[model samples]
Target: MTSSLQAALDPSAIAVIGASENPDKIGGRPLLYLSMFGFRGEVWPVNPKRDEVQGRRTVPRLSALSRAPDLAIIAVPGEAAVAALDECGEVGVKVAIMMASGFGETADPAAQAAERAMVARARARGVRMIGPNSQGLANFGTGAVPSFSSMFLEVPPQDGPVGIVSQSGAMSVVPYGLLRGRGIGVRHTHATGNDADVTVCELAAAVAADPALKLLLLYLESIPDPHHLAEAAAIARDRGLPIVALKSGRTAAGQAAAQSHTGALANEDRLVDAFLERHGIWRADDTTDLVAAAELYLKGWRPGGRRMVAISNSGATCVMAADAASAAGLDLTP
Candidate 1:
């Protein structure tokens, strides 16, 4: 396996720093889901306040651990998260998931400053941080599920070939569940909450290089660096891997709200559309469209020069499809 793929899939052991015994709590769900999903890796819970969480002995701190975990998931409050990350870095943990918020989104100036400090600390230590405000991430290929939402509550992990990257945590899970319901499998799903360090562009470039990944689906509220994203999209296009993007915050009002929420600036919707087109990336209008387009591409059919042939049992359905295609700027002459 390639080094990047190995690194992505080789998170053999994980530690939950704020794990709790209570099933309802945020820290308890990763442990619960990991066990229930039948993860093959070792699971450790670290909580100073608890003797044991979910029948597993809890380590008071990362310093007390014998072996270094490949990945660490921090579910503690925003204030304590930086310290936990520092401890993770000291232990030589490679990747970290920060599920706590109170960073860029918080209206308070002090909170934003604290968030910046956290990012700076992580960067200085050379540790890769996922989010100071995020839902979580999952590697279905390796059974590394580290998300907290009850969305994975009743579902079994369905391993597949598509890798998902989304800015919205809640939206990420929704697509996973939806795609699985439609018999599409996911290789990895990442919710990049308040992307302080790892941007969508970096993740997409990494996913493009992943041998296990056949397709990439992105749900983006805003792109921080258009140049970086364009370059990444170009790489994906060059590799002949299909990238389907669903862009939120398309309208002026929606853009304003997104900017306030993530401290991001949304570019003109038309400019984004042109950029994606130029990079050979497919644009999806809605959630269903996003999944459908991704599924079609992954199943190995590519459109020839934007021309499409319509087939329908009913005249009305055929006409509707033609109209939709025309509206989407697709050629339907054939």
Candidate 2:
């Protein structure tokens, strides 16, 4: 496992820079999540104005923290993200997840330059940055919810075998909400908004290491590193772990939209489809399709033969199931 990803995934302590008092605010939500989700490690809230953030004592600034944290979540605006990271670096923080959204998403030349500068600074300081506009990461098993997504409030987290990684915050949790609604437990649901440093593929590979993970769900707007992604898929396949992916931007309009959203070039739909198929990964059209086969994937079942039979007491049900089977590419033979 890479050192950076290891730090992001299993940090011993976390600092919420720009921490707020309100639980709903971006600055305060991580603290709220860590508390609600039962994170046991020390949580330092870095806020100058507040004495305490959500009952946890405030450290006023990153340097004031008693000890350097393994992971830091910068919740300030895009303009101040770099400065916040600078402090994190001074404190020797290993990884910083920037939750602000203005760096590269605007497609502006200066903003793009700022995004590069952020990455450059992180490297110089020996700290890894996850996203310039990321929603943050979640580990339900450890209760390390380093995100502000309200999905957890709506859909309670469970320590199951499912892992989720996405390029968009909404896309990441939307699928999570649906999968949870269907009674599936998820262990990791991570959103790499801009993916300035930690690409979705890298994070996916890290989560694949969990022995408990049976299924990995990915929602990507771009294929930043296909070689690594294919390698990750190969590893999962070897372990009998199925990877289901929803790579958006199928149409020209969708491609443009995705490009603007993530500030990256979208891979051609046909090529992405081919890549996934070659890697033994299933391609999903939407959230529903992405997780529909989830239960089946968890079952760890494979057909011995193509020939099959549909048995139902009701003639109508039999006909419907037979139609579904045909749609699923199963051959019905006597």
Candidate 3:
């Protein structure tokens, strides 16, 4: 699955295709967060209509740039996204995070067709697309601030041992921030939107091989391709790298919502649960469990089997920990 295209790019120097002057706009947030966090890479702004954005000189187009950017973040309107991507491909941009919507979710059939065409065109050029409808991707390991969400504004760059591969962009930042706040380090983070080319399986496979990474936390709405996911999970298990997965869309209503969001069907929740158990992957039911499981694993605590030793300062706390652990399907003994 390794390609020269993935190896050649720095994953550092990123260009914002729809960089805007308004901080409230989508494109403006990444620029703002990147500058605020002091990302130590050349941040290029590609917007022909603007001379400057966020105090940086904006390049009229990607082709006019003196240096080819390793990655491009697309924040333009859905109608212009493909055109921006065409420019990115011409300039040899390796990875692109398409933050525009109006693709599969649109009520108009023509719009959906156009979105598919854009994806086909980009893939044909050997350029990887992350989302036509996505929050955006981020790589904290390389100081790549590609997401435009304001949540990252308060986050500082800290490369640790855990890698977060999330399908939901909103979950990525929130989880990353919470884990980082708790002193757990993150090596890399990705929010795979739409997953047009790079799926969560591929992302997990890549993370499993990262020498600096010891833990992987995933927030998945649904596993679109179970075979690929199973293969990736097996790889992670072989490496003794524990994966804590929070699989959303458990209920019928939630499943419907997940499908609507990404046009993906939520696999049978029981099947996913059984699959994770067979692979030695921990399943988290809520945000607290997700964080606790990851934190415990990252800190080198592992149960010999499902049995765990519990210690608490108070009886109520002890009872709670035991109940919580049992509810998570872990045996709390001794």
Return the top candidate by lDDT. 2
Supply the TM-score for candidate 3.
0.85
lDDT of each: 0.78, 0.87, 0.76
**Residue 32, model 1, lDDT:** 85
Task: Give a tens-digit lDDT track for model 3, residues 225-315.
Answer: 7677777677777777888899999999988887677655678989989988887778988878888777678777655587777787799
Error of 3 at 249 (Å): 1.5
TM-score of each: 0.88, 0.92, 0.85
Distance (Å) between predicted and true CA of 279, model 1? 1.4
Model 3 lDDT on a 0 to 1 scale: 0.76
Model 2 Cα lDDT, one tens digit per residue, 137-163: 999988889999999998888888899
On TM-score, the candidate that comes out on top is: 2
* Candidate 2 least-lDDT 10 residues: 325-334
Query: Candidate 1: lDDT over CA atoms?
Result: 0.78
Residue pairs clashing, model 3: none
Clashing pairs in 2: none
lDDT tens string, model 1, 197-304?
Answer: 776666666666667677889888887877767766777777777888988888889887776666556878988898888887788889989877766788787655
Candidates ranked by TM-score, best first?
A: 2, 1, 3
